[model samples]
Target: MKSPALLGRITAVFRQSGAMDKGKGKVTGVIALTLGGLAVLAVLAFHFPQYLTTPDLRKKYDVAILREIMLVGMVIAGGMALANLIRLRNRWLNGTALALILLAAALGGHRVPVDDFPDNTPYVGLDWFILDLLGSSMIFILIEKLFPLHRDQPVFRPGWQTDFTHFIVNHLLVGLALLIVNFAIHRLFGWMVWPPLQKWVGGLPFFAELFLVILVADLVQYWTHRAYHEIPFLWRFHAVHHSAEYMDWMAGSRLHLFELLTTRVSILGVLYVLGFNQTTTDIYIVIVGFQAVFNHANVRVPIIFAKAPLKWLIVTPDFHHWHHSSEREAIDRNYAAHFAFIDYIFGTAVKSERRFPGKYGVLGDYMPPGFVRQQLFPFTWKG
Candidate 1:
């Protein structure tokens, strides 16, 4: 037998050689595939502008739909390529990466020309989805990477099906519901004897009016959100939102449609009563949109600063994560929408030294996925 030192040296050499070979192989494969894919996309973009820019071709096909199709396809292809690369440890998956690059190019290539819309008209729906939701998704992803709430949790995991469904219904489907609710509220409020109310509210300065609108809306939302927790009748619809096991940007979109409509109508009632200007109302919506999603995100802010002055003005991730927690103490606290001060003033604030919740999701994991079941949940006795 070899001496102890010699045997140790041999083992070390074997381990080092294997690790080095694995590292080098992975690096080489990633680089070769990425570069080869980008080169092909560059060539196609330069030579085949017609396939992308031709109006006749685009008219026959809805570019937005096609873009979504290609995006999904590319994502699947990239996933498969990455999986195969890991499984085989082979450079041949470079071709699969090239296919992904081409798919990505196709998705981005078919934007309708700026001149296609009338000079004054703005693109809506999918254009807004691409610009706003996609941009927000990227920002949230970056925030999670840079300032993760739970460092142990994987940032991008395999549990996105529920989150994706939530996003689709909450962001896209809710628009129609909001429109109907807004119209109905306005008509109903118009018949009321609040003529003087509008005149007074409308006379306020723009910034002041905007602040009031937000405050009023948040007040309504504060109560509505609280009711969703306190009232078992409403908890069913609300539980669907709390069903998310992980918190991220899209997590806020998991609310049930009935819950969404009820909450929105309450806020809209406040808006109509306050007679907010369209511009101010629009700005308020934008601010609330960012706040609603951001507060629920899995981001870590510096504790010292976040708990100090900032805590009074705006709801941070720490404040909102507690709301999502199933902890008994955190159950009814932090009910404020945009401001934590509301919770404090109302005696509902629950303070914690820990930044992130140990556990999330509803107290009992009873809710099922899908819109219809969630809508009917509030009335059912299964809670």
Candidate 2:
């Protein structure tokens, strides 16, 4: 009974607005709980690396470094929880955090050893999801706070649960998504690969190859994105993303699974056919990953991006936000993912007197809420 009550309190705290009550220790309590919870998950990941970790990521991770990180996280979480307990503030939250930390320590904490494990074990990308969530929150949240457009918008704004669920599901299924994309690419586009062209393209200077990669990929993305608006069936799949009324870093993750799979297959398929070097492709992935989150972030750039020419050359938050706008001037426009110029050249850039749209989301706001329902939306949607 006490455990259920504590859990309920934690959930209520999370569901509340992001504004912190430092005097009540609510801020520290939340941090303690978050870090302590992640520490427990980290321990499990360490204990069951074969089943919990990503194979590709495992190859690159240094166990020593990860161990040190885990140690620091546990120490901070424990310290915060203990401090709050001594102060007798937010006792339920801090108590729960301490309990999680103790449980993690009891289960071997960060000291859990990793021995030999079999290759190709079927696994969800739990490690990937955890690390990425931690990293993205630290980086993007800081940026949004420093250069905020919607100053009143809280970090845990309304609909954050939906977006966070999307992020978790998409990341956890990264293995499956890669598998599907690789299979489709090899089976369907293998013959399209011209060796001489691939060799030539791969041999280009690194920057040149990277530029070409972005250009080619963004072109495919532009057309695919436009189709999602111009075609009724495709719009249903895309509407799940546009249903996010609030713009933030995590909001970009609210994509329907079908759209995610098809879009990745289409863009990566073209890149595969082109046969760019692995290094260049890796760099492009990093760029795309950063921009995807950054452009959706509730951030405002004061000077450089205010210029029209630069906005046309690069996809900024201002530019991408317009694509998510419900206003008539912005509807079905600004489709390019990386290069804003792609939209301009295609005559799809938004024409507006206002600096930003007054409203966002689909014009009619027809889409349903929640993760499962949104995924099922594309299939069941009548309009």
Candidate 3:
């Protein structure tokens, strides 16, 4: 049972002057959830932040600026939540947000911890979750709204809840991902670590090393991505990513846990073996994160992009959208993750005349929706 006031508000919000409609509810809901969740996390991180923030992540920086940013974001998101509630007229809609604000305030919002922090604990990555969620939404959502390739498409299209759940799980479990990958790499490649090799890698200029990292990572990703498409068993899991009918920044986040783990460990192992500097690896991580969201975003490139070299330099929305299109020509094309050159070299690049995908999803439309079903799909699916 829902309130009429909420229903009427949702109707008005959905009926607003732009691409918003019933479909846009997901977008608004996602934004509202993101703002509220991050705000709450900011608070929790302040109270029990010693456990929430990982040593590897916090080694180089402090959370002072981030805490202040969270406080401000909490206030702003609270307002946005209110606006959405008014638009959607939903009480439950704002109730969670209200709870977050209250809890954050009660837990000493914006108050920094002055006590000695413990290093050995189960790291939850609440801080990283807040940072990445807010950062991606602020950057990509803005771009998608301002320059949508699918003009009629809402920010939150169908199946967004599924993708949002995927986003949350992946970000919150960063510690586990890091733990698994690092453990595997160390045990598998430890014997190969040599001082000469390390010195050579460490000696390279920052920019040169960065270039090499991107190239090596993209090369590994190309083959890995191709394998998921070409290999029958792997396709069982990979199909979950392709199952999304809507392509947005969040679309890229809808990956199976197995697919996520294998791909990350594989590429990261290559980087580790090559002895890329710690700083270079860190920067590469940030670059990869940004590119992943940007390439999958529903934003359009200016007409000038078609004539410019930007498309050749890296994967753009147009280039990646073809990869997600349900059209026959796009089924396995544009497999490169960061750079576009590998796709060109291998002839896997999109050669379609379409500027954007008319449709998206697996070719057979076989994969199921919802996070749990998608996660269990590979184990239970029938060919």
Per-model root-mean-square deviation over C-alphas:
11.4, 1.3, 4.3
Candidate maximizing lDDT: 2
lDDT of candidate 3 over 191-252, digit per residue (tens): 77787887898899889999999999999999999999999999999999999888889999
Backbone clash numbers for all candidates listed: 0, 0, 5
In model 3, the worst 10-residue window by lDDT is 17-26
Q: Compared with the true structure, what per-residue lDDT tens digits does model 2 show for residues 223-286? A: 9999999999999999999999999999999999989999998999899988898889888998
Stretches of model 3 off by over 4 angstroms after superposition: 1-34, 78-92, 112-114, 308-310
In model 2, the worst 10-residue window by lDDT is 13-22
What ranges in model 1 sit over 4 Å off?
1-108, 111-124, 369-376, 379-381
Q: Rank the candidates by lDDT, best first.
A: 2, 3, 1
Which lDDT tens digits does candidate 1 get at residues 149-258?
87655443334455656665554443356566868788766566376888888889988898888888888899999999899877767788888778878788777778
Error of 2 at 129 (Å): 0.7
Find the 10 residues in a row with the least total lDDT in model 1: 118-127
lDDT of each: 0.65, 0.90, 0.79
Residue 311, candidate 1: C-alpha displacement in angstroms: 2.5
| Best prediction by TM-score | 2
> Candidate 2: TM-score?
0.97
Candidate 1 Cα lDDT to native: 0.65
